[model samples]
Target: MATSPGSDIAFASQKSMPSENLRTKKLPLSEEEVFYMNCRAVYLTVFKSSLENIISKDQLYLALQHAGRNPSQKTIDKYWTPQTAKLNFDDFCVILRKEKPTSKAELLKSFKQLDVNDDGYILHTDLYKFLTKRGEKMTPEEVNTIINLPNINADGKFDYIKFCKLYMTTSGQCLKTALERLQVDSKQRRQQFGSHMEELPARDPSSVLKPSPRILRNSDQETLSNRGDPRASLLSTARKFKASVTCTISMAANGNQNAKLTEPNLKDWPGVQSRGCFFLEDDGETVSHQYRLHMAQRSTVHLTIKPLNLSQVEGKLSPWSSVDTALYILKENEDQVDPQLVCFTDLQHREGFGWTGELTPGLYRLLPSTSGCRLRKERTPEPEEAQLVCRDDAGDLFLTQAFKAALSDVFDVIDLDGNGFLSLEEYNFFELRTSGEKCGEEAWLLCREHFDTKKNELTRQGFMDLHLMEANDREGDPCDLWVTLRAMGYNRALELKEACPFVIDLHAERCKPRLKAVRMEASRGQLEKATCQSVLLQGEARAMDGYENVLVHTRSWDFRITSVIENKSDNKVIIHINNELSKNCVNNRGLNVFAVEVAPQSSMVCQHVMPLNEHQEWVHHCVYSLISS
Candidate 1:
């Protein structure tokens, strides 16, 4: 028989009859197995704290000695080393001081008290006393600079209000910096606390906190004596097992109280903030909005939110949640709307794709793997929407010409006759009346036949009256022809009025200053304005058409003014007229003054009354030369 080494087993027992039992009851031999065995034994003991509690170096060394590690003092210093303790002493006090002061009034009072000097200002001398009283040793110059800021009153007094404000602002800035640093340090501590430790689940379903065995053991006798219900026998047994204990035992419970405790004060880890733009479209118009959010790094994102119902979204086309749906709706309802949607993440990167389908208005969430998104209305220009009115000084070219072409198509459809002019009757086909007075049903039908389908071409003058002029019934005057021409889109209508030639025929009885009569020929453009200019030539009396005619020219701006001659029948007719600058100066290239005069009862013509400057294009010069030729 042999005894096991280092154990107190007697050699006699080894040789005894329990050999089979000893062989069956062997202990675990690995370090982990041994530690767990010791842990179990310690758990059974009356231990007052958690297994994760910090163990002192001496206690740890004692345990190591129990396991047979007997190194020298210096070696043990390296082995049983103490950690650099966390700098959290008075941490709450530090936090308290870092908090912003609540009441500004108190700070101002304190500042005023610290000012010390009865003299209105706090100077270097004043600050010395103040700092000494406060046990602070700031430089006098710094104190003086603070006290002497521009905000000091006109009397050079450092008001306590200003001083308190400045001090609060400066102190808050310093506190903010310090707190930021402290926060970073605290975050690092939290990371280190969890770094090497076994991970705890965010939630625990199996463990509950219960009273330790000591409480059961101490309460067992009393619990058994007072047990009123037979169903509480287990509770009585539990009482017998634990007494006078406040231990938080981690064990499985069937109820819902098994989860681990979490602090509500703790915040989620800060992540990156990103912004994206999105659009809402209604009818043909699209409005935009931006989405900014803080997102977890390297994590999946699930966004589901409703669109903002902005007031600017009013229109026939409602903003659809999905771009594809909106596009489909736009195409299907082309007769109703020309819908477009545009998205822009970056202005510089404008390559966009569209979806072909109709989408109804509602909220939709976009799911993307990336950090941000931007959607905006695709700014599609409808040049055809621009009014069809012609440009006077210059015709619409390039983009405008495209618009004009569309208008021309519309006009062709409206003009029924193949004639080169749009008559008043033909113009009525488009629901545009030629006169203020209502026309008959026959006139409307005739207009449709002549203008709506005939695709007739209309002259510019006829077009002006048919499309542009509005009937003006003021001062018994027929109409304002110039306004109509303007609305009709002729830029040079004024110039046209100035350039229209006029002729007048006058007849009178001989010598008695008899009643005078005169007749004039006026263009349609002139007649629109109800004005005409004519010169009366001085010559021998002749038949109504035989009066000697002298050519003279006249230009007028006010259409209302009509010139008349007196005593036209008797004596020889003498010319008395005025020369004036014609308004129809097409070549407004530079400064100019032109003159025109019309003889009495005479025909007149004046053409090309415009000034050309050095800046005028060579093309203009060529046109002028051609016209002159």
Candidate 2:
């Protein structure tokens, strides 16, 4: 008899089935492959070939229970709810293939792959394609902006160096990259324009990018005068005394107390154009005044004083009243003399009697309106209290200079043996005394491993190296522990109960599950029956085991699950729903499908009858529709 093709195929399969099974048994599946197979089986069993299959809460619960996989409600909501609780072929592939570059080298490799042209740069189009493949939906404008970042080349291309710098750091916002590029550009501009702007005013050292104010010169005065401005006269007069002056003055207020005076001069005064003038008066109402007033150069005048009796005056003299003195500056091309009020004062009161105004640099004369009036240059007492206050303020100088000096002091104190070296025991003692905390066993071990030798315990250099290494690992302060303690002051160090509060040890071991557990009670009956037009079912199935325990809420149809039965042989589940309301508009009996209609005011119970997997799929659809609504 001749064998058909189908029959031949079947006979061959039967003959090779045992060998295939043996081979399969010998080669165990990998964990990832096994997981994929399980997921595929669950998907096929629940959805079959239907494109619009939905997994309801109860159905999903049963499926998960059968598969022996339980996931939290939060996980389910995060991954499933946003997709309407349905898994399409694309979504299934996404869940299985989701991954990201784990290292800088891997990211750079991927970036190079995106450079399709074999050039050293990535263009805008390539970047857009790369981001799109990674499931990032970006607009053309956004892609252009990213590709045209300041760090990128002018031709809108990304180089490997800049790309690596941008992604290698934890802060990937590209701010640092932009700032670096900005600094480079600024330097380039400065170099290019430095020669052309050589005449620009120099910047002050104390401030950044600020030019010092220009001093007015004789040339400036000439320039202003050529412009026919009134300020030219003032400027000319102000600049004439910019040279040195030689003048002296003395004051004898009571004839018995005479005070010598410093030479009134403009030699040391760079911007000053005027100085105070002084005179002396006697108690017998006699006045004597002297002034070295000149228009071109310095001059001196000495006057002899004659005493006047105030009782001989025509009008009665009040004891508290004093004569008014005035000084005036002679103005050029004018008959009137401008009062140099600011330069005049009574010797007794040490203040102007009538007027006080600024006296510009010019010719001036001192005159007294009545007797017993003279200018006085009072001998100001030394400010010893002020000097003491300043000395107290100088105490803060330690804050600026104490870092190095205090470090030296601490090092000497810590070197108890005075051998210029610190043993492990000595270092520990110093640490305990300074910070109130002992070094860890691992720290000591690490120090020994790196720096310990047969002869030397730890030299100064070796100790510094070990300390720096530890500080770097723990992100601690780089300053010496003893030095930091001394800088903080003894009183402040005593106030701190714990040691090294500022140092954070990132490598220290911590308990499992670093995040704290938060208790979240499921919300029940939050939505009223009248307000709820649909039902919401949530929670885990494997959490409930093979039982039908679930959180169910309903609104329009006042229904509840009365009982649930599962058939293990056929993999079928039966859910019986009971209506709470006595009067109902729809027939509520035996629902073999997800949705059903019933006669109004009829039976108060309903049954959803379907295969176990099919029932779960139908419930998924119902839940999805409810959520979407």
Candidate 3:
């Protein structure tokens, strides 16, 4: 999002925080607590494991993959399988309390065991069988959580070596802190058998993996038919079927149909902001074509990683992302980023990871990143259609010759003073027409930073760079740029669209405004070079016996006339104004010709000056007369 034709900046806290106890410092968890944390740290890694408040051996296996540390199945069997009971979340708290932190050599050896073919890759089937068939079986959902999308390729192989290398870089303390952030106290496990309740709402008991689906007998069916089973097992019971808690990650916008708009985050992150997904598009993190959602006012972004075949994700060298990628939300302004409100949703989320509170109105990019950190772009080819339009070559930015030529002509049109640089006023004039927006001073400065500029005015190169920046932010989506192109009169073929050559606007209260386009005595051509320049009260008013010539002049650009019309006729009179000469400059809902009817002996004023398009500017002299109604 290197500024979506917009900007960035991290946030500074605006609100004064209420004072708290100064002397007390929070202590870190030790032993089993830390181990339990390391297990739960696999939140997104184990698919919906966060919500259940408990984990299975299958879950532990996925967590181990994430930590790049795997223990022997014997260790698992001795410490875990002895209890033929549902595994509660608290059961693993001390699984490692007595043992030292697993060593790097042990972790490496653990990974080596799974590479049966010694091919330097861990196959998905090898892991799926190892975790499910032995120790505690994990649901396929859990296994898929760790092995899906950006992590594993279509052929189902994991680069365990690369993952292990990244693991080695982090120190023991950093790893411990990352793991224990959420496991501060004893987990509020499910209230068992009506024991002294803690006055908190109860959730469904965490599903325990069944060895196999229990087949129902005829007697069992008859008994069920007599009394319908209201509650059915929600965990995987058979080899192919799973019925865990509802998958909230896949919920559509309808999930938040009553999404009320709020501005909570605005107080924390104030200043010039953008208005779309907050991703650094220049960083090569592009969304799938269909997923580039724009919210005019409000929208719920469904951020699922596109399959490798659909879109190439360059996370092979990214350790954390390839192992446990997440979609991070960050607030951006003027090239500064403030993770004002930060949260991570699993790249393979199933625990309903979503905006827990009101997502304040502003630009927020959901980056599929190694912790939502902006990285240098290692981009793939942009969207096919956009590149086709621009036809970029390697390192050429692919800006097509046609598009560049069109932009050059556009710069000349908007430059206004023949200085070869577009001033703020001139640029805003272009901006207002093409995008219906004004590029603010800060935005202009950003333009300077990214592109070529002189004396603060955007140069021709800067203008081109600005468009390229927009295209990059959109991940090669062509709609936005095309809007500007078409507005500037570029057609699909990049040819200038046909336009009406002359335009005039005026309103007179006591005078009927009449306009006409007279051919130039020389080689039929436009008169001058000023763009959208309008000088007010720049006209002469004269009275004649039969009619009046209320004249206004075009100063080489778009102009308007404002005057009053008076009627002293005994009967009603009709005066008509025609803008046929200025049709191209009229916005939608503006008419070419309008009549003003005045009552007997009364005067009528034109309601508004002629409405015209700023896209093409002009000024014209006016003459008026009356007709009997």
Q: TM-score of each candidate?
A: 0.18, 0.18, 0.25
Q: Candidate 3 at 265: error in angstroms?
A: 65
Kindly list the per-residue Cα lDDT of model 3 for residues 420-539, writing each as its tens digit: 788887776566555545667776766677678899888888788777776666667666666666455444666442211111111222222222111111110110100101112232
* lDDT for residue 297 in candidate 1, whole number 0-100: 24
How well is each residue in 1-629 modelled by candidate 1, as lDDT tens digits?
A: 12224534231111122125334865445443333333322221211222332245444332222221222233234323354122121221121222213345654444555456644345545544554344323344434333333343335444655544433343333233233333334333233221111123333444322323322233322321211221121121111111110101111222123221221221342212111122122121122111112211232211122221212345532132212111000111324332222111111101111121112332221111110111222234422222334434553212234333333433443333333454444443322211223345554344344223234334533333322222211211223332222222222312111111111111111111111111111122322112112212221112222122322222211111112222223322322111112232232112121212223333323221221221232111110000000
Q: Give lDDT per model, in order.
A: 0.25, 0.29, 0.37
With candidate 3 superimposed using the best TM-score fit, by how many Å does residue 286's alpha carbon deviate from the native? 40
On TM-score, the leading prediction is 3
Runs of candidate 3 exceeding 4 Å displacement: 1-388, 391-397, 497-566, 570-572, 575-629
- Residue 250 shift from truth in candidate 3, angstroms: 75
lDDT per residue (tens digit) for residues 1-629 in model 2: 01123322110001111124323544554444344444443343334332433456444433332232222233234335543545443343233232111344644565666667767687755666754444424445444434543333457576754545432331221222222333334332232121122123444434322111211111222221112111111122111111111111121222212221222332332221111111121111122221223333222221111111123247664222222332221222245333323222212212122222233334444332221111121234422211000112533211212333333333443443445666555555555434445555565555555654334366655544443343333234333333334322221222211111110000101111111101111111211110121112221111112122221232111011111111122222212122221121122122212311122221111221111221121121111000000
Indicate the residue-level lDDT of 295 in model 3: 26
Better of 1 and 2 by lDDT: 2
TM-score of candidate 1 to 2 decimals? 0.18
